[model samples]
Target: MLKKRNFPAVDLIALEREACRRSLATFAQRAWHVLEPATPLRWGWALSAMCDHLQAVSRGEITRLLMNVPPGTMKSLLTGVIFPAWEWGPAGKPEKRFLSTAHMQTLAIRDNLKCRRLIQLEWFQSRWPVQLQDDNNAKLRFENTATGFREAMAFTSMTGARGDRVLLDDPLSAADGNSDAALLAAELAFLETLPTRINNDHSAIIVVMQRLHERDTSGLILSKGLPYTHLCLPMRFEPDRRCETNIGFRDPRIKDGELLFPERFPEAQVAELERTLGSYATAGQLQQRPVPRGGGLFKREWFGTIPALPVGCRFVRGWDLAATEDAEAAATAGVLMAQAPDGRFIVADVARAQLGPMGVERLMRATAEQDRAAHGAVRGSFPQDPGQAGKAQAQHLLRHVLTGFDYHFSPESGDKETRALPLAAQAEAGNVFLLEGPWNAQFLDEIALFPMGKWKDQVDAASRAFTELTTKRQASSSSGTLRGFF
Candidate 1:
């Protein structure tokens, strides 16, 4: 026998109002009815996540935040429409100024109108003390009597205005992804312009968009290693890619390949999206990865992995050298590959890092020593650049750094794509295999993207190593002895 406990009508009303004021999610639910009376509320965890992170920003906990979500997840409605209004009314921050932008002016203005419409509703006005200015009628700009204003503009048109919060929603359209110049300009804008538009060090910048390319704004920020709290939620759950943020936020899904928001977008709908969007679009827009699944030119299924090295295999390590530890710069990569007895290629190990000239030499020498200790008679293949400086550098490594090692230096001929063709053919034919190690993911990702990927140091080293290994295999067949060079 259980009895139901009930509060007074007045008390219940007060409690509901207090809850709406305290939490952004509650406020968004209350505001959604006023904005979309015909549409039902299909609430999910993804919506709650955006609200939580946005509230954290409103509380001055996070200054820079980047969110990568799918296309139809109501990202704009939460960030562009509801966030500023809730902060002004419920959160008691009526004086907060906001600047919001999208790829086009029309898109920004559309969200601006929605926010203004929600704020002017009778129910909203009765509860919150927000008063709009009489002259605040422009689609691009609006103001409240409490000194809070929201301005809308294109991402390229961001200048001559500052705000307490900057919201960038879908800053680049996928239609323009084919133009490399356009992509570069968008990245440059984020790096050079957007930072200048913030009011102060305390101001917050929030970017919400689906990844469109490897060189998009999100990619640039991540590659440059800038300080931003990233919250990436793909359409499906990938256990290996479950993102954990600095704010103690992690994807709660435990199952692999589970739907992110099945309430709104069911499994069937997601399948249709994948089929229609194709692999490239689906990967960028839905999966939050710029590369296609199973890879681009180098298919993931084409290569296999082995647990241990095969017996009677000849080993060689290739070096693609670079100086300076810049995040945007190319890294020095070394690939240790083996030619098995049955004429198959095994990628035993890969080591890559951005370093100075001295650091590069140290790593080369260290890698040589390690390879020799593990696999006997592992030879080194170093690339020789054109001209006298290149010859001097190669001679220096052979004489000073690698004094006792068997090595050879040869000038690299042809472009990177052409040189990688032979390896790509072997990989396509299922002849290329990888030795099981911790380096598989990065190595495969780089190889998958191939010539189109941003960094090619690892692929270049692997290609050179494969060439060196095969060349020796052919030479030994004719000469009947393994030749050595120091």
Candidate 2:
């Protein structure tokens, strides 16, 4: 049935995974929704996955998990209602422990109420072999005719409670998430608090929340490199729920209201997504993208086009000199970006080090070698300082080294600000790449603060190199025309 749905390759994989959860004696129920009427309108492989993993937990095959869905995808509904009932049902331990967590106490309590409500339903009571305690006990307890109890808890209420599978739901509030500091601190609290409190025997965890921002708990959880599943279903509008290389959406265990996400909101909500969050949020929240910072110019994105160079791609050493001790000199090397017609601006080299001229030169040679090995020997580009003395000094150094590389020395006329403005525009227009790395990042930030031509020596060198290579080729093309002048 799943194969007939015409889902994307990734969605199909999610559906298959969700379906596989049934073999462990527990069922996620989303894939089986068509078989049950009250199953609700949740069928999409990712949504179904929440059901699937919870089912696996019931069977003890899985442990910790993370679900980073977009907002309004009925994440709470599945966690609170459907799975808990399934837990106490065929696959349930009854005596086993469970905990539902959220950023606030009210949310946990609300989920607790849902669990209680579902268990008390007439249909629910018929199938449940175990008898749940009366409401008088409070704190949302369900018993399997034994002393077993599952409870609700807040992030703040961790002092006295312990559980086998602790669920740290969206432990970050929507408001506080705007502040990276608060979110980072809360994320820290999760790892530190749980180990101190949880029991040694029974183990696991689940994180359920929307992907709100980069600095949120989602980021924190990913950084730890723990083994977990991410389930997401963006409900705001037409959502790209299919998993890409770096992002994820809902797990494919359930279907959610016949593609109602797109039908419910669609274009209008997308506009809001654009207005409120820009492309970063749109790519992450709606499109499920790997966070595009500022298009193709930011250096990080351009590294993908690296290639092997030919025998003579023209070795050119573009020197953006910087003195490690002098603050102003240090800021000079803003970009060590390299590019080709087909290749993106890969991180060809970085000239950042607290070094003397020789040290800087060494760094330059090492980077040039790397580029040569990775790419190939290419002609070098050097900025001709407007002053004749500086230009002569550079020429003499190149001539003395016996370096096989050609030094295209050209005089550049412009303030740093004016020179970089074009690069910035070109960057914004997708004409450059930082090839995103630590050194490249520092280089750009410093360049952004450069005072016109004052801090532009490095930029001058780099631009001159690229321009020299390109223009020389152009001039070479018109050599016949010059001869015609005779």
TM values, all candidates: 0.68, 0.52
Q: Give the alpha carbon lDDT tens digit for every residue of 1-486 in model 1.
A: 889989898687677679988899999998888899999999999999999999999989999999999999999999999999999988888899999998898999999999988888987887785888989767889999988899998997788789999999987898855556777778877888899988899999999999887878888889889888999999989998998887788899999989999999999999999999987788889999887767756787898999998899999898898989897778999999999999999999999999999999899989988998999899888788888898778878887888788776777889887788888899999999999999999998888876546778988999889998877433431221222334
Q: After superposing candidate 1, which stretches have Cα over 4 Å from the reference?
A: 1-14, 300-426, 431-445, 450-452, 456-486
lDDT, model 2, position 293: 34
Q: After superposition, how far is residue 115 of candidate 1 from its true place, in Å?
A: 0.6
lDDT of 2 by residue, 1-486 (tens): 446556698676555444433432223343234224664553454455556566665656666667766666556766655566566654445665667677787888787776666656654454455676664347644544555556777774566657666767777765664554566567667768765555554577777776555556666667567666654444332323443322233333244323335533466775676689665455455543324433311333322323342232333445566547555234334234455556333334555445666665566556655655665545555444556686665555455442544334444466544544555555555655444445555455444423211234555555555444344433441221111111
Against the true structure, what is every candidate's RMSD? 8.0, 14.6
TM-score of 1: 0.68
Badly placed stretches (over 4 Å) of model 2 are 1-42, 134-136, 139-145, 231-277, 287-290, 293-438, 441-486
Per-model tally of clashing residue pairs = 0, 43
Worst 10 residues of 1 by lDDT: 476-485
Q: Which candidate is the best by TM-score?
A: 1
